[model samples]
Target: MDTRPRRRRWPIVAAGVAAFTASAAIFSQIAFAATLFSDNFEDGDLGGWSKSGGTWAVVSDGSKALNQSNSGSENAREFAGDTGWTNYTVSARVKPTSLPGNGLAGLLARAKSSTTFYRLALVPGGVQLQAVNSGSVTVLGQVSRTVSTGTWYTLSLTVSGSTISGAVDGASVGSGSSSVASSGRIGVQTAYAAASFDDVTVSDTAGPAPTTTGPTPTKSPTPTKSPTPTPTSGGGGSTPTGSWPSSTGSVSVSGTIKVSGSLDGGMKRYCCIGDGSQSESQDPMFELADGATLKNVIIGSPAGDGVHCLGRCTIQNVWWEDVGEDAATFLGTSGGDSYVIGGGARSASDKVFQHNGNGTVHISGFYASDIGKLYRGCGNCTNHYERHVTVDNVLLNKAKYVVGINTNWGDTATLTRVVVQSSSGIHVCAEYTGVAKGSEPKYLGDGMGDGHCNFTSSDITYK
Candidate 1:
């Protein structure tokens, strides 16, 4: 059952043609230090900042307003240039008026798109850190540091490695961390609320920031199955070699091989082998090659699990559609890092598509529907020793059960800048020593629940 709704890409408009190329150059001049990246909202030229097409309106205050009222947008600031900063800090001063339905204002870091990135916003109610992986956006942390509506408030956001910390009015409000493999562009954002931004800046907080070298593009590996010879038997002649037959194929794998096809037709038997235990055994159509970095691949199937992994793999810009069960299932028998980056899975059942063995699982920019369990660790399964699983910029549209993180057997998992719109059951659950406890997860905007999870012990801001 395809649970994914047809998504409409929001059109963005660049306000003024004032390209602040000097902003990046200024930052680089200061040893790539922090530098302002705005049009100063002084001149009518809003630099390159844009709005979500006409979703928001821009107005100027005729009177002497903060940062020259004639400059800032009326409602919200939209996406802009791709300021490539791997590890840096972004801060802005915003004066928010009446709280919009989705009131928000802040700096957007590692922004691949308007819907996928890390956002640090300050509302009339509080401050929040959110990430949008795929279509799902998760609120990693939030604090009740209320800001007076229509008043100017300085918001500072810092991102180093996988951790993002935020402060309001120079006071540390909320902070959290997650695993982000790649660096993305930056921008500012506002919902359906009027806000004014001033002194927007981006700079390296730690040592020298990495240069904005374009992303290294990788090719999708050609999928190959195990070369098991077919035998002529009573079932149905000889089973096809390399390809699994839906009627009478047996499942067996000797090693691992790159996968590139779908088993739309039901398969009775399937197996694939690679070099020295890099093996993958699955009964589904798609199989991710071990240690293969995949980019821009689509997995389409009919009411079945997408890919079941028996080894480690790295996937990026991948999409799974119409999966009966989970999209991608991982059984870490070999014990290595398995990653899923920038993709969504639409499933009929619980979207518990990706499971982890003892290996680490890092998911960024992922969206799913009815996610039963994002990452499930087997009982006492530590072949690779699962350390940390980070999910960044993940959004769950409709989850009847647990939405965020659900680990059965004790495995450390981190949900950063994540958002869940509507959920019918708990948000997060973890089972350690046969005892599961954590915040009672609920629908969107609900505060954190009390439980026996590490999140409760930490200083996590919830709205």
Candidate 2:
């Protein structure tokens, strides 16, 4: 049986993050450097970040950073990650600019709320690690050391199963066991203090040498896969806010890079491939072998052929700066599954996804803009396969058509929570008549059909 797409709503992450874009916004989960989320707040806007009981904005403190500027708000808090983040490290540069005598500037992990989380905080008398639940606080570990108001300190907090550990400026502050909150969001907090935070980042820190952590940087660095499989539910501990992200850095690809296990780009821009014009001979920048997984990568302009999957694969939290020939192509025929989750694509002069294989392609919590087609089932491929796709919680920004399918081949597309951001009138599902390899596919009418498109007008929303 096919699984219904699960909707994920997380916070505004950095460019390095997998879901939404912000500072570093490098998103992926599993092991060391598998950055699931980060934000420098350089974009000067908090698009996907959530706030509670605080006055917050992007303020320059050395550089762009999220700052809570209200000392009177006793429980000022801001979140920039998913509620499903578990077994990860959340770190940030924190400066207590206006702390009261007993106020605290803290970094939070497994934050279920503004007051509920495991915290590594700088207090007046010292540093403390505590578990706070429903506004109630319990100290798990503490170290006595005075902190300077104007000085910056690196606060690092790691949560694994029941073990919680924290550090300050590379120095161990505390480690202990706690069950207060096992899994939640990542954020920054202040209690009776105003502070500036920067370079906020979350990376995978548990599971052995992280050998299988993710992308060992081989071939050039030869990448490795994390022993941990990303939950089919969440990739970067965050949900996208339906906007494009900035690139923290860029990688030039000379040729197609083959991925055998998994490759997490940590949300870097991979470009230098082809021209923006449609060309059939353009090589893909990355190719995934059967069962391979690609995460937290941004495909920049001239994006040859975005990504190709030979068999079962997962495209998690990947953004396309510009759509190439196609954003991603699924060529798997093994009746396995492929997923496109939590990312956005823009300036797609063509289709965003091409399905030329068997089995199902599930896309959930995704954003698309100015595209010819968000998804297309192979219309004239040599092999006749029954393809299926389920799209849920997606924002279609001025999209021409949501999905195009070959009705003759028995292709099916299911759409839900599709927010259409344009009055241009998009085709929810456009049907086509498959032809031979040499002929063009014929276009058919669109609407909910018995077996082709399984959705009603209620499944779509106009904005």
Candidate 3:
């Protein structure tokens, strides 16, 4: 039963452009460091800070710290000291007493107003950096790091020129860039969470001026453009004798290859591996060798997996359309790191990601839609092992999974800032032990799907 929907290419392409080029404008500016404002919250009141939207107060015992007690839809913030500073650093000691329904607490720097700012959030599953401009939100980076409630942690966020960076405790989490709102106020922020803060400080940094760099023109082999995949024909035209696999094709690779053009499958299906079905070819258009790095390529509709990557590989800035099975498959000899960044795979009757072996996979700025399963760990939980998968800042639409968690095998699945719409969502298997934030129907109940598996503790949110 193939339950995936047929999706168009334009929307996916547009999203790919936005996803990959998000930091293009901001990354050009260089940054330096300086001190701005520091608040220890020694007073027992919210005196110099401006409150917006949620209930906020300052608590005092032997020490003083700011607190917010709202667990509702409205977010809470307290702006203090500066509103004209840009390219600054904000740091604080914070503790979250309660996190309700994907709640978050963190620092808000370069805030334009109550609704607009650069946010670096610390949640139950991980850390996220986002840019909110004129009420529109854009997630810049998401790093998976499990944080517990009622624990004090130091969070520091720096915006130097166009670069935005964050750190927790002492180690760096992740960094992202945006030039949307250049200058604004510094504040503390929380969403759907009740938290307390102390020793808040803000610093203005000296940064380099922004500059634009143009591309250098050079002659190269022109890549092929394959036709979109359709139900009737396998893909578009047939593969020419000298292209791709053939030595004469525009794509020639010994180890790593970056294709600037699209690939045509020639409507041919190579029958080998697929999702439960063997009649359909499971072979990818290009079977990547181990240690290969493939980037900047558009994979046309293939009969099987679009690119079968073995061992450690890096796939970046690639768009996939009209695939028969998973868009990309990561198989490890033992285990390794497979990275999928800044691209999307759509319109598959099978899963978007097929993990058949044990490995660590990082997928970020990735868009997946219209697939039977968003992620397929082990087929049978007791049979094979599961891989460590971290999905960050991903947008999933019209996708469903039969067993969302470790169906039969390996380990943790950490999902952050994932937006799900009109989808069956994921099944929470007993073996899965991670969190899914900003996504609904995150777990399976007693009588749902293949029946529920019992577990001691689960942070999964079910509706």
**For residue 236, what is the lDDT in candidate 3?**
14
* Ranking 1 against 2 by lDDT, winner: 2
**Model 3: per-residue Cα lDDT over 154-231, one tens digit each:** 987777778777777766655656886687777787877888888887655656322223221132212122211211
Alpha-carbon RMSD to native, per candidate:
19.9, 23.5, 18.7
Give residue 83's error in model 2 in angstroms. Answer: 37
Please give the lDDT score at residue 72 for candidate 1.
Answer: 31
Off by over 4 Å in 1: 1-36, 50-58, 62-77, 100-102, 208-463
Write the residue-wise lDDT of candidate 2 on 249-334 in tens digits. 88988889899988888888988787777786788888999888888888888888889899878888889878868989999876
Clashes of each: 46, 27, 14
Runs of candidate 3 exceeding 4 Å displacement: 1-34, 208-463
- Using lDDT as the measure, the top candidate is 2
Ranking by TM-score: 2, 3, 1
Q: Clash number for model 2?
A: 27
- Candidate 2's C-alpha runs over 4 A off are 1-230, 233-239
lDDT of each: 0.49, 0.76, 0.57
Q: How many residue pairs of model 1 clash at the backbone?
A: 46
| lDDT value, residue 217 of candidate 1 | 14
